[model samples]
Target: MTESSALPGLPRRLLADPEMISACASRDFARIFQLAKRRGGFHSSRIARTCELTPSRVGEVISGKRKITNMTVIERIADGLRIPGHLLGLASRDWERAEIPTQPQPNAAMRRLAELQNAHTTVPSRELDDILAIAAGSKVTPTVLRSLQVSIEDYWRRDDEHGGEALRPAVIGQLRYVTGILQDTADPNYRRSLHGIAAELARLTGWTYFDARQYSTARTYFTESLRLAREIDDRTFIADVLACLSLQATYQDRAKDAVTLARAAQDSARLDGGTPRLMAMLSIREAFGHASAHNREATHSAINEAVHHFEHVNPEDHDPTWVQYFDRTKLTVDTGTALGQLGDAAAAEPLIAEALQAEPTTNIRARAFHTFWLARTQLQCSKVELACATATEALDLATIVESPRVLTHLREFRQLLGSHRTIPAAVELVARISETAN
Candidate 1:
């Protein structure tokens, strides 16, 4: 079946409409299917054949009886229909025609082709020119830089509260805008300030991407931020970025890299005269890395150093805004988590529980993460019933937040629960997770 034969009676014009493209990009598959069948005169069987879906599944999707959550399948559908990749959050397809089809009578086909061209090509160039002009025309001021920093801090807090998935796109957009401003600014002092803001923004973006499980993109932003921080000789910022990288490494199970990065962050913080609290935070990260590496002695030493430094933290000492979230509760949690990672669940449990109880409601993602860890600790200690209950709570909270980090933890817990599937609670939890995934 040829493409044209499969799509008999379907107007090529409607397929290329900007609105239709937008719908596809947004995953409105049901609406797109309906429009194809109703207005374009295409059939379910044809769409299924072209998109490599079963005809029954296509009908189910069109009737809203099923949801299409697989990105690969969505991409396949977009390709099959010749949907502009950019409209579906993908790169422009190579086969896209450079010129729109010219028709004597301005028909739907011509209009559709024009819309696709505008969306894929013209719009981006125009937006870039507008951004550059605005940036070039604006004078870089201390006030402007300060405002941008404030906005970055605000978004960071929002990301913590709502989860990275909820705010990543907006943060990325802001980062691009800031990058433009940095490119256009000429004043050295203003440039330095803007660079600092941009570095922080980059770190924030990296952190969000990490939470969202986009490791490569996260590393790219982290590397860029670290470079910017070094160029400005901002040691505190440098240490923070290093710590961010360390955390990512830890999550990715690169124990040696995690340890090295965390140690570098600690050393950098010390040399840069970072506040005691900041040093403490770095030390905790080092402890985590050591724990992951199964170096119990080093882990214990690092945790002790962190506690000592934290205890010495002066209330009056100036600290970076980024380190504001590191308090006693966070310290306790990190120490406990490190212990748990090192197979010392008995010691880790009470500390984690205490930390969870003290955790603020605003940090929903953190709460869920802590809950998952607590559940893991429980399972490690052979507290199956309690672990299942705690895991269920974590799963419920995971549903509330959009953080992939939390989901990752839940997935780990799911693997652990697989052994106890005979338990009713574990069975139910497994079912719940499967449903959530689908």
Candidate 2:
């Protein structure tokens, strides 16, 4: 197996042996157990503990006297062994926590991200044959494509309500399945429709990774989605992908790149005669980029432009399905977030609070994000007590959701509270964050 294909924390020598990966991918626990015991120098007792199997069972499996068929047990073995999720026909694992070298590794996250750029995996010939047979027997229909679209939308709603970590695996599996179907479908029209849906799936997967704070993986998906969108001349999707990229760049502190990408998205949308609402979304991203760069004049200008476009959104305008959620509440929250980033807390607090109050209960992620921003604004205004209270509320909401992005923000808030640790509320908030992190 190539270094890129190796799962995190496994011995290099074991990965160098190609059979190891193949064995794991095929769920040949017997061979895996034997190889790991012999070649990998792992003790039978250690393997048993990791796999949650008795030592006798491990020996029996290795000796070909027993078979492991439980899916839950299989998952535990895969996770405990740090096996790559995709290799086992599962969703991608949390690459972020994968153990690597103890040395100071620079851009380690980016390296891990690069490994996932390609969706290709080498399955056993038997598995490949089964997939081909399934593909050949299945017929592609408009109804099927529509249903896939609806499923993607449902997953998006769930991500908003629950969190990325909760839904990432399921969505990744869906994307993989859709991509397989796309490869098998021979009809030209069906292929085109599948490509569009596949692009959306890729975009969704990328956003989920982004919320999980896996930026590099997110970038890879967005890039692939852009390529797929371009294949079908999907100008709207292209703009959306670019806008998503801009958001990722902004979070990474690549302010200039963020602005450039956001502007490119806006220009693409305009050239394609995109919906005003779509343009508004892109413009808001641009404003955010400017705010991050501390370019107050540019930030306000872009914000105004976004507002203008949003206000003129035609109720009958042909908008993309993805932008259906871009409404007044979203605009208010995004604008407030940008302002808060610019240190205009006095102006941002009320707007953010109002947006949070108006936000639907179903959008747990958005509420957590908005609450964090509101707390940040309060901190900026030196309202420490109120900030602590609001941050506690954000933390409470954050605990129920699985957003790494929200967790990161909460950590930043915790850091801010560090200076005011003498205050009782700040001290309590710090302890709460620490407990939650553990």
Candidate 3:
């Protein structure tokens, strides 16, 4: 049976579907094609024909071999499939205005949600624009919940590899939609799961903004994350959000607030019977907070505690999904980063090198960040030549990665190099960096 109507495009039922809606939100057309086939009675040939794509290209997308990114191509897909332009983060299509009267009128929430999703938008880019839009979801279902969960994971993975600057639109857009549905939803069997979904989305939206160094907007989302977590009484994720806030505080140079937030997170984790990796991640954050305060003794103590907790982590422990990044590699690099802040280059260098060696090539952002830290540690030990060389590599990566925060770190490091500015190696690195500004 056709889920759509007489038009040669997709049906209204598919557009309203949680699974398809999630796919469209992220522009995962392979999933979209698959869903259309499975749920909307549309085949690859049909999608290809309507979207102005080749059958072979459609096949590659379905098999995960390609992604569609051109704005024009995306618009064609939106129009050909009769999808609303707002859903794809595009301006309204001519066809949308021509949509027949039999087609349901889209409300303000849908239109405004589309407005905020535009990366070039004049909109304020807030997380929630219309409360009624959030309340406009269909009855919650397991399938709907599962589809959103996967998208969230994908967003984090992408952020890890390339940073979050480009992901803001999709992340924030889905968050607004999901959070609205969550508040208005009262499902007895799936209510808590929905809250978990909303909490994580809010946390991720906050994180993308954090990665961009927009602290004010980031705090609003993090605050929302905490509230949603509290609704579900999920202490693990609650602690996670607190740790994130603590890290943000460290960045903002609020050492006292940083330490206080870290400790509060730790206390909450303990009450939840924390996992080893969770405790390890929090401990390092605590260590960083102390280093910011210039408390040498407390810094080392927390470092020791972090290492101790990490040693106890086992694959079977079933750590919360959020702490999956806290593997030995992460623990090692983070420990090195915290120690570097304390100016203990001798203790920090080898650990950081090990982390860089094991770091996956796909995560360019992490490599760039850790490479810069390595240079700083080298500088701390007074290895001016080696530090300059390593810093040059960091500059290369920083140029390509989409993080302003990494560039900011590079600026701070340049100030630290003022005394060495006259050195030959330092001079060349400085000139190279200066060229980027030009």
Candidate 4:
């Protein structure tokens, strides 16, 4: 049930797949485990320690005793192995569904019809009409027809990803068609749909770069997305882009830039009578700025305001699918971290507990931040045993995601732990943190 012998160097996509496939398509557990182990840079001892698994258990997986059937387990393995989860088929998302039919081959006439249908509308409807007219008399070859269909599909795919290349001019040219349609259309519903597509496409371009940690490219994409959002008069999306810009600023430690962007977002939302959600988001940005400056009073005030706004904001009020993700619990989690940084563990503990209890499924990065703060709070309170455990958990998650922000927080945690070197457990955890740092 293994293709490892037949295909020694299969692409990473195939190496990472966990789903059941057609006959003759299967994975070699032993080969995959070895590959993961080699890529992860871990010996047996290190692997066992990080995964909290027994040495025997790790050996069994490597020897193919245990099948890699569990998604969580596979993710854990990838993390421990230091392999990019996406490259290893441990991606947290599914690929886009293809539009073309997936089945047995069609007959010659059916294939011809498909090719004609795939022809770009930008080629001129009249030109297509003329081609169809000519095709009505002459027979087309299946080879030529299939090639045309593939070219058409490729154009659309490229358009979806990067607005298409010059060879795919018809696809990019559709942007003009969209704009023209918007101008002539009077139906609000159609305009809304068109604007929504533009926003999604624009955001996807930015997300590709942002997720890859290419900040400069992401900034440009976000700026372009914001411009399109303005053209469509979508205030929510406009605010979202502003929030993203502020996020970039925060990541770069430009607190003043973040504050300026957040204030601009607040002004725009105010014109529309600032909803609870928008106000909470703006306040969150302000909190970030205050926290960066270590201004306890200002940070607390902004965080408290955010919590107040979040409590009243109905998740149903937002039309943007992403906006509904915000909640009071998450805002409080952030507030707790800010409070802890400002040396208010007494004020921070309760909020951290509430956030932990909420069991939020969204925003792992934010949760990681909260966990880092909780660890700091425990350390400051002389609870070395508990602090070390919390710090380890935060470090593990941060390591899995390769987040610089989380690593920075870990550095801070290490500094705190280093000051209290008497506890053996704390010292061991600090060693682990140091190993990861190197």
lDDT of 2 by residue, 1-438 (tens): 423234334575575343464455446688778788787766788777665678998889887667676878877677656666765667766652555544543697855544554446443354432453364455888888887788778678768876766456556655776777788789999999989998998998899889888999999999999999999998888999999999999899999999999999988888789888998899999999999999999999999998999988998999999997899988998999999998899999999998888899878888988998999999999999999999999999998787888888888888888789999999999999988854
lDDT of 1 at 270: 81
Worst 10 residues of 3 by lDDT: 125-134
* Candidate 1 lDDT by residue in tens digits, 1-438: 556334433366775443354355445588788888777766888788777789999989877667777878977776666666765667775545542445433788767767777678553445432444374465777776776777677677657766766456545666777777778788888888878887988998898889888999999999999998898899888999999999889989998999899889988888878898999999998988899899999999999999999998888989998998899999999999999999999999999999998999778788888888899999999999999999888888887677877877777778888779999988998888777743
TM-score between model 3 and native: 0.77
Local error of candidate 2 at residue 342 (angstroms): 0.5
Cα lDDT for residue 64, model 1? 61
**Preferred candidate (TM-score higher): 2 or 4:** 2
- Pairs in clash, predicted candidate 2: none
Regions of candidate 2 where Cα sits further than 4 Å from its true position: 1-138
RMSD of 4: 14.1
Model 3 lDDT per residue over 169-199, tens place: 7777677777667667777557788889889
Leading candidate by lDDT: 3
Where's the lowest-lDDT run of ten residues in candidate 1?
123-132
Give candidate 3's total backbone clashes.
Answer: 3
User: Local error of candidate 4 at 413, Å?
Assistant: 2.3
Question: Residue 259 lDDT in model 3?
Answer: 92
lDDT against the true structure, per candidate, is: 0.80, 0.81, 0.83, 0.60
- Which pairs of residues have clashing backbones in candidate 4? 16-88, 40-81
